[model samples]
Target: MTRRKLNMGKNNVYMKHWLSDKDRFADLINGSLYQGRQVFTAENMSVEDGEQGLVLRKTDGKEIAVQRYRDIMMKADDGTRIVVLACENQDEIHYAMPVREMLYDALSYVDQVNALRKNHRGKKDMKGWAEFLSGMKKMDLLSPVLNIVFYYGEDEWDGNLDLHGLLGLDRIDYRMLKKYVPNYRINLIDPKKLENLECFQTDLQIIFGMLKYRKNKEGMKNYVQNNRTFFAQVNQDTYNAVRAMLGSGQHLKTVNAKEGGTVNMCKALEDLYQDGVEEGIEKGLEKGIETGIIV
Candidate 1:
């Protein structure tokens, strides 16, 4: 098996660190994935370091050192029930994301099964090996693992959202094969597709709301102009992330340097709008002159 290096740029690195915070991570998951379920809390969440070692050996005796790292993994308890949660953050869309996510979930299940066998009281008995190895019965129930993909790309995700979607099958064949093939659907949280801003709480409301309008400069400007109070109350880290991700970092810095207070994104948006308008007019004028000369 060939090993691939995990390459992350400055923006992705910063985002990973930012999401590493338990509170912030929980807030995002609970708000977006759970939909106000409020089942997750910072106190209950714990980060799990991913697997690292020789995952496979080829027939040619070549060993492969592979690392599978998840962005976030934790167990959340709602007083009586506990569920395992894992999240993968993607800045870009992956076409084979469903398969990748399936692998992660499968690995987690394998680990859980191994742990069960190790802790079994009857391990010393001869029947223990048969029972554990045969996968006939289990002494304990495994917690359900929920895997989610948090996609933060500016453009819409065009990749397949489920295992079935990846299979190249005709409509008739797909219906026929449905019974034999197991389907796993990816839980994708895409900010660009979100419609209800009111569904979000805390910093996420602002983050997703801005992302929903990130491509529309005029829309963003209008949003900031109307919701000055909301923009003003944005935390510093979130402010920086939004401005940087939206290509307004320089403008934000200039405004902050001049005014020397809480960064007003509304003013920055106004400047960006004005700059865009001027640039458009200049291009239009140039095009008009060229057309006239040609005529």
Candidate 2:
């Protein structure tokens, strides 16, 4: 297999690692996706390293390598029912996210079936063999999997959220294609679209609040200033994530988070200022040369 480095920058890396934490992952799922229907603890969640190898055949019968990985997976039980929850974190919008998520769910079901077949083979009894031969009539139990995509990008997701949308069908062709293609929709969590900040219990409340008003500098500043106590209480990871999300240039210089000590927000701002100044000088020089040419 060919090894390639992922180009996800520091912000994306930070977000991925932050979401990998059990508590944060569970909180995000519960607060955002399920809407507190299923309360999941960190103990119930597990990080599924995104590394699955599969080969696909093209129309020419040439095989190509494909690997799949989910950001996090969790097994949750609400006493009567059990479920497998898979989450994918995206810093940017993927046009084929719905199909990608559907594929992931399908692969998980396939894994379950394979595991059941292996278990059936392990049974040496005549009854087990008989049941296995009968298409595993006794092993009908399978956990339902729920796939969710958490989108944290600054802009609105313009991608197709439903599989059917990618079919390139016209209005007239919709009826014809209805029976042939299945529609799979993505459960997208966009912090920017969140209307109620109270729904979130953890630091996500503050985080989402900031995201909602990210475009308005004065609004974001007011939010951070008003929630001084909350910022002071938030852990280092959350603090850092908030800083990163707000852009490296904007951060709370006064608030010293307890977990990772003091974060220097001013230094990043200074660097940004220097960059802007240099860019302005370059632009000025270019404009001067253009004027000289015109003369």
Candidate 3:
């Protein structure tokens, strides 16, 4: 696997802020995971505290904690069951993502079990020895958890996508072991690789579309110009995200956000394009003078 270290100066703050918005979060999940279906809505989903509290008790009474922090987490409860969705913003391709995600899901399940245990203890109900030790009733169920790694890096992901991908099963693993070994998969969302840009209903469409060419100044300028109707004005969050994703430039620094916290991406891109042209002309003259080619 090709692992590129994240730039020490770069961070995922902008991506976290962008994904924290419920509308954008739902759109991203639906578009990327659910075939563009409206599985989650801004109204139905409620943001939850993502601090991992699921812990294991020791014989000496000291709790062994598996603490983790998530960028954004949301929960939705229907009449039948509860569902949890967690987002982990990644600035680079995480080589051990499958195991990382597996732990998050496992901890969520353990938390659910703890909740069930507390409820049963409060009600003074325990049917058998199995329920008492397990911290859950026989019929008790756990909420399903889905963790997604939103990778917004400059390079393609070449790391393992699942637990099986990480294992060296080629030499010794037989079909018999497959039944005993449980495998886990990581849900990954790569905006640059998404083909269905229209699936997104928010500024995300513009964000994803622009991110695909973030490395190419010419392509980025063309993208903004082509989407001028929307790029002329974007909210502060989206603007900050675009600037962060594409990296800082002279023109980007010059464009002040509007009074109402909106930025003119169209104007910034145009100025940036103009800067490139002027630099090209100046550099050409410099080269010509150095070689005496223009004489």
Candidate 4:
């Protein structure tokens, strides 16, 4: 593949490039959210705008507009149903991720409501006051928004995983409050915790597998050797993403180019440890720990 210098700033940008592929996007959603249930496929998915924005009227009649961008978003339609799928790439842990995701989901519903209302108003299809006031018919329902937080960090996650975890409502004193407040959970996909890497059909399988050993030089080398054929011929974006997330700069220098926009990952690994396995491993780990964004 065409070798390019790694952009150390915002590695998540590289992640978006490779995972943007329809097939790979579907594969990631299926494997991460559905546990390989095959609930989504590239054929039934269409890319959607990742921007979420809406205006809300407050009790004082003042309006506020807010906007947020998702790392990736798509529409999933399966004849009888449609759902919105969004992925948020994270290099470091956000302690308030649950609350952030909850806001994104709420705004998604608001966006849909605006669209549905616009269509109805254009067609002059309102039947009653309820439809007119709400901007949608009583029976109309919003598509469910499922957001997954894809954490590629190699370190153990010590952060809370749900809204309730952040709410501090689990104590006996707040039992009554906890019973009434529903919990919102994040669909977290951590490479270190992935046990069913085989569920992935694409290079995502091998990529995630190798990520689990990112800090372990010997272990990562072995994993690459084990999946040599596929990694040895990955697309430019794929190689860039993997190397970016894995902190390969401390060791890896050039990507050995091959035919058809592919690279030999085996040779890349060889150069990574050319100075000595332990030295390379130590440097990689030190750099990863320094950033608190290991993967």
Per-candidate Cα RMSD to the true structure, in Å, reads 5.3, 5.8, 3.7, 7.2
* Candidate that scores best on TM-score: 3
Tell me how candidate 3 scores on lDDT.
0.79
TM for every model, in the order presented, reads 0.76, 0.74, 0.87, 0.86
| Candidates sorted by lDDT, best first | 4, 3, 1, 2
Clashes by residue pair, model 4 = 1-262, 154-294
Cand. 2 Cα-lDDT: 0.68
lDDT of 4 at 25: 88
lDDT per residue (tens digit) for residues 16-94 in model 1? 6666677777777777766766767888776776562225689999987555777777777767777778877777789
lDDT of each: 0.70, 0.68, 0.79, 0.82
Q: Provide the clashing-pair count of each candidate structure.
A: 0, 1, 0, 2
Reference-based lDDT, residue 145, model 3? 91
Task: Flag the better candidate by TM-score, 3 or 4.
Answer: 3
lDDT of 4 at 57: 96
**Candidate 1 whole-model C-alpha lDDT, 0 to 1:** 0.70
List pairs with backbone clashes in candidate 1: none
Better of 2 and 3 by TM-score: 3
Give the 10-residue window scoring lowest on summed lDDT in candidate 2.
1-10
Distance (Å) between predicted and true CA of 174, model 3?
Answer: 6.2
Worst 10 residues of 1 by lDDT: 1-10
Off by over 4 Å in 4: 1-9, 57-63, 248-251, 254-260, 277-295
